[model samples]
Target: MLRRNFIAARDLEAELEQWQERIDIIRHKLKFIRQLPGVACIEQLNPPGTAGGRIPALVEIAGGTAIASEENGLLFPPDIVILMLPGKSIEESLREIGSLLEQPWFAESPALKNNRIYVTDCREYFQLPGPGMIDSLEILAEIINAGDFHFGFEGLGWIKFESGSPKNG
Candidate 1:
C-alpha cells in the first residue's frame, strides 16, 4: 500500500509539472512587447477600494501594472479599470458601476474617457483560487492586451462598459 501511494503521488507531481510547463508557454506567448497598461481592479464600489487577495499579483502576471495606494484607493489614472464584485454577475456589476458615473473620479477617469472599463464575472472567474484563476488571468490578458491576445472571452466572461448604453444597466 505504501509503494502504491508513493507511485500515485509521483505521478500526480509529474502531471502537475507538465501542466505548469503548458501554463508557462501560454504566459510567454502573452507577454507584451510595449509598456504595460495601468490597471485598477475594483472588488468593491462603496467607499471604493482596490481588489484584495491574489488579484494584484495576477494583474502583474497578465502583463498589466496594478496601480493602487496603501489605502486601497487609486494612486493615479489607470488606462483600464476592471470591476470584479464578489458573487455578482456581469449585469449586477454593471448596475453597480452605473452609480459611479456620478462621481467626479469616475466621470473624469482616463478609463472612462477612453471607454476602457470592463466588468467581470467574479463568482465564476475571480472569486475562487485554483485552476479557475488561470481563466481569470486569461481574461485580464484579453482586456489589457486587446490587440494581441483574443481568447474570445468577451461578452461571456466579461463585457466592456459603455456609458449611456441601455444594455449596460
Candidate 2:
C-alpha cells in the first residue's frame, strides 16, 4: 500500500488463495498416485515405447544413490530399461505392462528350470533361473515394472545397478 501502482491488498490475497487451491489439488493427486497398485520412484522417461512409457530406472527403483557409476548417466538406456516389481505374478504382470518395454525378458536367467518357465503358446517359451543368478540379468533388456511386487523366492535383496558393465565379461 506504500505506492499507488504497487498493488491492492485484496487482489494479492485472491491470487494467493487461488495458488493455494491449485497446490492442494496437485498434492491430492500425488497422494492418490502413491496409493496406486504399482507406483514407482521414477523421475523421468526416455520415451521409447508407447503403452508403458512411464517406466523407472533400476537404480531409482532399487534405491541406489549413485547413477553415474553405471555405464552412462542411466542404468538402462532408452532401448534398455528398468521396472519396479510392485506386485506379484510375473507372467500375468508382464502382460499387464504396456509396450514401452521391448524384448520382454525376466530378471532371472535360463539355467535354473524351476524358477519361471512356461509355454502357454507352442510358439513361445520362457524359463527363468533362481534369484542368485539375477545379478546376471540383461543390462540392455528392460526391467519389469511394479510398485508392490511379491515374489516367492529364497532371497530377494535389492541390489544397486551401478556395480558393473552392461554385459558380463
Candidate 3:
C-alpha cells in the first residue's frame, strides 16, 4: 500500500525500493527461525487492542506465534510477552506496566517467570504503519530468537523487563 501510494504520487521510488530490498533481506534471514515453534502475546497499553494487527504478522515473520485476544480467552500462557504503549518512552511504558505487574495473571505468567517480558517504544517502531515497521520486525526477531539473532535494537527499540526489578518501575 505504501509503495503503491508512493508510485501514484510519482516520488520516492528509489527509497521505496531500498526499503523493499531491506525487508526482503530480513525475511530471507528469518526463514529458518520462522519454522520454529513459539507463542508470543503482545499487549498494547495506551491504545489497548488485541494481537490482531500488523505486529502479530511481524511476530510470525520473526519466528513466533502471536496469541490474539480471542485466543487469550483460552488462558494459554505465552512464551514471550511484549508490552507496547504507543507514544511513550521505554521508561514510561515500564511505569505503566508496573500496574499490570500486580495482576495475578501477568505476574505469574511464564514469560514473566522466565524473564521473557519485553517493553517496546511503539512511537518509533510499532505505532504507525510505515517503513519503520521493518525496524519493528527486527526488534521482534531479536526478542523472539535472542540466541539466534541480534540486530542491535535492544536499548533503543525495546528492552527486556525483569519483573520486580526496581529499575523497571
Best by lDDT: 1
Sort by lDDT, best first: what order?
Answer: 1, 3, 2
Ranking by TM-score: 1, 3, 2
- Candidate 3 regions exceeding 4 Å error are 1-11, 34-41, 44-49, 70-75, 164-169
Weakest 10 consecutive residues of candidate 1 by summed lDDT: 160-169
What TM-score, computed on C-alpha atoms, does each candidate reach? 0.80, 0.22, 0.74
Instruction: Give a tens-digit lDDT track for model 1, residues 1-169.
Output: 4554355888868877865764675579766356888898888666667786788888987888897734434688788889888899898888788655654466667788778889999878897766677778778988987766676788889998876533221
Between 1 and 3, whose lDDT is larger? Answer: 1
Compute the lDDT for candidate 2: 0.27
Best-matching candidate per TM-score? 1
lDDT to native, each model: 0.77, 0.27, 0.69
Question: Which residue pairs of candidate 2 clash?
Answer: 84-145, 84-146, 85-149, 86-146, 86-147, 86-148, 86-149, 87-148, 87-149
Clashes of 2: 9
Backbone clashes under 3 angstroms, per model: 0, 9, 0
